[model samples]
Target chain A: MHEMALCEGIIGIVEEEARKRAFAKVNVVCLEIGALSHVAPEALKFCFEAVAARTIARGARLEIVETPGTAWCMDCSRSVEIRQRYEPCPSCGGYHLQVTGGEEMRVRELEVD
Target chain B: MSSERIIQVERDILGKNDRLAADNRARFRADGVLVFNLVSSPGAGKTSLLVRAVAELKDSFPIGVIEGDQQTSNDAERIRATGVAAIQVNTGKGCHLDAAMVGEAYDRLPWLNGGLLFIENVGNLVCPAAFDLGEACKIVVFSTTEGEDKPLKYPDMFAASSLMLINKIDLAPVLDFDLDRTIEYARRVNPGIEVLTVSARTGEGFSAFYAWIRKRWAKLKQAERTAQG
Candidate 1:
């Protein structure tokens, strides 16, 4: 799964932060995952544990904050919340909705010792 | 006893890949090379389409290919047989190609200034959608034999692609593929996606594909000239 690669990216970020900030160990890694980002939180957790072994983030707990998917409905001329990309606008029932939010996968913060 | 402290990072998870991709894009722009990333499921005829396209367009334009696969270099071999430069990047347990891999592959190839570089991404619809290799556009190949609901099932890939090529159209009549519904589904996910139907076997609909590439290339050249002036 690509989650493994994403986890590797996370580890790289964490290790870099550790070097820059003079941190000895990481206790928790906070992530902001969007519902429409297509990345599964559970898979991220599984891969994070495997990829974090022996690193500064080894045994670190992952805290994933899920953000809702949001889109701008061109027909309704209003913003709408969507759970998926193919979803139609709730108000006008049109497929002309432009995704406005909830496609992010960011590492927001970290808890370190 | 050590105390735990929170550190604010505020970084995108794919930030490294994105930066690398931006670098690749700058390199491509400097060379005036129009690149397209071709993606699809396994056996969606990505290599076949490239073989046919390169064979016809090589005389008119200098073309190079980067073939990504998990194991074999067979697809690269197929492209090389057409007397074009093609390099194979074997991902080795990786599901998709990343920007770093593509950058390395591009470095290995000969200079292809004022030409086209086609990257045939590993035959996968899911993971490849997330990684950008600095391509001007992404073309997704959906064969008729793969059923129509693929766009619905794999909305991310469909949504990310700029153009969808309905491959294996010659087998559409023999199978129960509904061409209209497939287009509808793809459009539902991505309203701006362009669609074209073709068969690599019969060399059908390739003229339109070449025309599309030429149109984009002309626009790119115009933009480059305007930037210089």
Candidate 2:
């Protein structure tokens, strides 16, 4: 699964931050995953435990904040919340939707000792 | 006892890959190369389409191919048979190709100025949608044999692709594939996605595909000239 690779990327960021901030150990890693980002939080958590082992983030608790998918409906001329990409506008029932938010996978903050 | 403090990072998880992809895009633009990332599910006949496209267009343009697979040089071998430069990147346990892998593979290819570079991504519809390899656009190859609801089931890939090539159209009649319904489903996911039907077996509809490539290449060249001036 690509979640494993993504976990590796997370560890990389964590280690880099550790070096830059002179942290000896990480206690928790905070992440922001969006609904449309195509990342499974459970799978990410499963992989993160394995990937974070033996690193500065060893035994780190992962705190994931999920954001809702949002899109701008061209037909409705308003913003709508969507759970998926192929969803139609709730107001006008049209597919002319431009994704406005919720495609992000970001490492927001870390709790360090 | 150590006191814990929150460190604000605020970085994208794919920032490294995105940066590398931007670098690859700059390199391709400077070299005047039109890059297309071809993606599809397994057994979608992506390699077959590439073989046919490269053989047909090689006479008019300098073409190079970068084939990605979990473990196989067979596609590259098949491409090399057409007397074109093809490099294979085996991703080992990886499911998809990343920008770092593509950048390394591209560095080993021959000089291809003012030409086309086709990156046949791993035959996967899911993971590849997340990684960008600095291609000008992504083309999804959909064979008629697959279920029409694939677009809805795998909306991310369909949404990310600019063009959807309905390949294996020769089998549509026998398979009872509803081309219109499939197009409708794809458009439901991506209203701006362009659609083309073709069969790599019969070489049908390839002329339109070639024409599409030429049109984009012309626009790229015009943009390059405008940037210079």
Candidate 3:
């Protein structure tokens, strides 16, 4: 639902640009969901269409990119790849977890000409 | 420029939500709070276990809970009756509690300075596994009544969990529940996951569960103290 609102904003911009360019078709859309983003891919897929309703962006094929969750462990004194929190540091049994990356949910790239 | 061009651009579906989730995770670590995001199916007895655990440990360890649901603050109210502060996040038709929701929910909780925070995610097994709420751990709950094939059926949840709790064991004998097979299947999918058998309703096998918590709590506090000193 949150992502749909965001996608609506994106679609608006895309629509404006497409209309300006006078594009006939949008073949595919490439999307990335950060591991820690907590956004459901399926739900996002459903919401994307809902948000794109009555726009120049209906029935566009969507490509999903899943990014992994990364965290910095104070105990290990190193960066770690993590899918969740409260998990013991894989390298060292430490509880201090600081997520460092893969928390970005954005349109990394798109397919249009 | 009447010609339409196929543009190849890579983007994320969850734009702001992901950024906020990472922000929340960083904030949690910087704050030295261990957050456990609990995911389970409906009637899996997540709240029941939390209530029992809170009731038992409230006197010793300071804790708080954040309950997520599609509607109603009913779970929060139930948690509040245990004498611990509870905050509710209404997803309003959203099936799962995302990191942004957790971050907002935590801001609304009371007395959460260096306490164990349990986030009971909305009652669904699939999407909740896909999202990390910046919790110190993700505890997936399953009840005997839910059947044992849950692990293989929902391998994603098993794969995502650090620990799985098989609750409602008091009724295990009444129902044809097989503990060995359940744990085995779960282990097959997630070899590293720690599975604990418990019954929140009758306190069966709770001693081991409490011991596990005590160990986790001790280690967490020790790390925090060391970082400070």
Q: Which one is best on DockQ?
A: 2
What do the candidate models score in CA lDDT, each in turn? Answer: 0.94, 0.95, 0.76
Ranking by TM-score: 2, 1, 3
Per-residue C-alpha lDDT of model 3 across residues B1-229, encoded as one tens digit per residue: 6343556444444434557778987877676666788889999999999999888877876788999999999999999999999999998867788787888877877656566788999998876875667787889999999878888777668767888999998888889899998887776556678988899978987889878877887888898789889
In angstroms, how far off is B2's CA in candidate 2? Answer: 3.5
Give one digit per residue, the lDDT tens place, for model 1 in B1-229.
7688999999999999999999999999999999999999999999999999999999999999999999988999999999999999999999999999999999999999899999999999999999999999999999998979899899999989999999999999989889999999898888989999999999999999999999999999999999999
Tell me the tens digit of each residue's lDDT in model 2 across A1-113: 89988998899999999889998988889999999997889999999999888888899999999999999888888999999998898888999998889999999999999
**How many steric overlaps are in each model, in order?**
0, 0, 31
Give stretches of model 1 more than 4 Å off.
Answer: none
Candidate 3 CAPRI-style tier? incorrect
Q: In model 2, where do residues sit more than 4 Å from their true spots?
A: none
Among all windows of 10 consecutive residues in model 3 chain B, the one with the lowest summed lDDT is: B8-17
Cα lDDT tens digits for candidate 2, B1-229: 7688999999999889999999999999999999999999999999999999999999999999999999979999999999999999999999999999999999999999999999999999999999999999999999999999999999999999999999999999999999999999999889999999999999999999999999999999999999999
Off by over 4 Å in 3: A1-27, A31-47, A54-59, A63-108, B2-15, B225-229
TM-score of 1: 0.99
DockQ of each: 0.83, 0.85, 0.22
